[model samples]
Target: MQIRLQKIIADSGLCSRRKAEELIESGKVKLNGKVVTRLGTKAEETDKIEVNGVLVTQPSKKITIALFKPEGYITSKSDPHHSQTIMDLLPKELSYLKPAGRLDKDSEGLLILSSDGELIQRLTHPSAGHTKTYMVRVKGFPKPQNLAPLSSGKLKLDGYLLNPMEFHILSVKDGKTWIRLRLTEGRNRQIRKVLDSLGYPVIYLKRTEIGKLQLGNMKKGEYKELSEKDISLCFKT
Candidate 1:
C-alpha cells in the first residue's frame, strides 16, 4: 500500500512527522529517483526512497541515546558559524539520529537523541506536559516570595503568561544561589528568561532530569544507549 512519504519516513524511525515535513520541503527527500518537495507525495514499498542520495532502508534495530551535553556545544547537527555541534561529539554511526529537544550552546545536560519519531514527539511536544527539571545557579539569592509566581502561574513575560510549576530553593551561599526548577513548557530560553524577569539573573543552568530520566553521574560529553527498559519507562502509558 502507498503511504505519504513523510509518514513512511516517520514510521521508519528517521524523525517526527513534523520534521519529515521539513525534510521534504527542503528538497532532501526523493521518491523513485524524483525529488519530492510536496507535502502530500506518496511512496510505496516498491518505490525507492532516498534522503540526501542514500537509499532509505529499514534498520534492523531502532536506537535511542541519552547524552550528557557539555557547555559550549551546539545542539544542531551542523552549524555555519564553526561552533562545535553535538553531532560532532557523537559516534559517526549515530549520524542519522536527531536530537529530540535542543540545548543551548551555553547550557548543558540531559539531551535525548533518537531515531524513534513517536518517542521524540511524546517527549518534546508541549501537550505531553512532561516535566523537565533544572538545577540552576544564579547570581543572587531571591526571596521565597519571588519564586511563588513560578507555581502560581502568574509570571507574565513578553505578553505570555506561564503556567504554574515547581520551583524550590536548594541552597544559597557566597552571593550565589542554587535552585531547582521544574517546568512543563519548553519555551526558548525559558529558564533564563523567567529568572531574568524575577530579578535574579541566571549564571548557569543545566537540565538534570526529564520525566523520570536523570543525568545522574553521567560524565560530561558522554553518551549511553537507552536500554529497552529505559525506553519503556520513558513512554509508559
Candidate 2:
C-alpha cells in the first residue's frame, strides 16, 4: 500500500508530521534516489526512502524508556549555544530515540523517551486526559480558601480557563510547604503559574507521575528501559 511520504517519515519517529513536511519541502527527503519536494507524494512499501542521505526504515524492535530527568538539563535534541540536553544523559545506544513530551530544566521527574510515534501521540495529546502529578514546594502556605480556585477548574490564566485539577497539601515544614497536584493539561510552565496565582509561588517542582507511569524511587539522572508489559502498565493508572 502506498502512503503519503510524510506519514512514512512521521511513523519512523524521526519527527512530527509538520516537521516531516518541512523536510520534504526543503529538498531533504528523497524517494528512490529522487528528491521529492511535493507534499502528498505517495510511496509504496518496496520503494526506497531516504532523508538527508540515510535510509528511512522502521526499527525491527520498538523501544521506549522512562527517564528520571534531573534538574538543569534541557529537554531538546540540541541547542545552538551548546547547552546540555536530556539526550546527553542517555546511553549512546538510545540516542536515536526522542522525548515524547518535555520537562523544563528546573523540573525533574519521569520523562518518557521513545521511538513509537503512535504511543507518543496517544500519551501526550490533550484529548488523552493523561493526568500528570507533581510534588510542589511553594514559598508560603496558603489557606484552603485561596487554593479552592485552582481545584474549581475555573482559574483563568492569560485569558484561558484551565482544566479542573486536584491540589492537596502533602506536608507543612518551616517556611515552606509541599503540595501535590494533578493536572489534566500539560501547559508550559503551568504548575508554577497556577500555584503562583494562588499566592503560593512554587520554589521546587517535580513531576511524580504521568498516567500510570510513576517516577517511583528512580534517582536523579537514572533511566530504565520499559518492557512491553511495563509500558502497558502506564495506561492503567
TM-score versus the correct structure, for each prediction:
0.82, 0.83
Q: What does candidate 1's lDDT look like per residue over 1-237, in tens digits? A: 777888778866666788889999999998888898999898777788988887776433568999999999999989999999999889898887878888898899999988776677777777887778899999888988977877887787677888787988999899999999888877788889888888889889899888778898999999999987876655432
Task: Note the Cα lDDT for every prediction shown.
Answer: 0.84, 0.85
List CA RMSD, all candidates.
Answer: 4.1, 3.7
User: On residues 88-120, what C-alpha lDDT tens digit does candidate 2 reach at each position?
Assistant: 998887887888889898888889988786677
Q: Pick out the ten consecutive residues of candidate 1 with the lowest summed lDDT.
A: 228-237
**Model 2 misses residue 18 by how many Å?**
10
Q: Residue 204 of model 1: what lDDT?
A: 92
Top-TM-score structure, candidate number: 2
Clashes of 1: 0
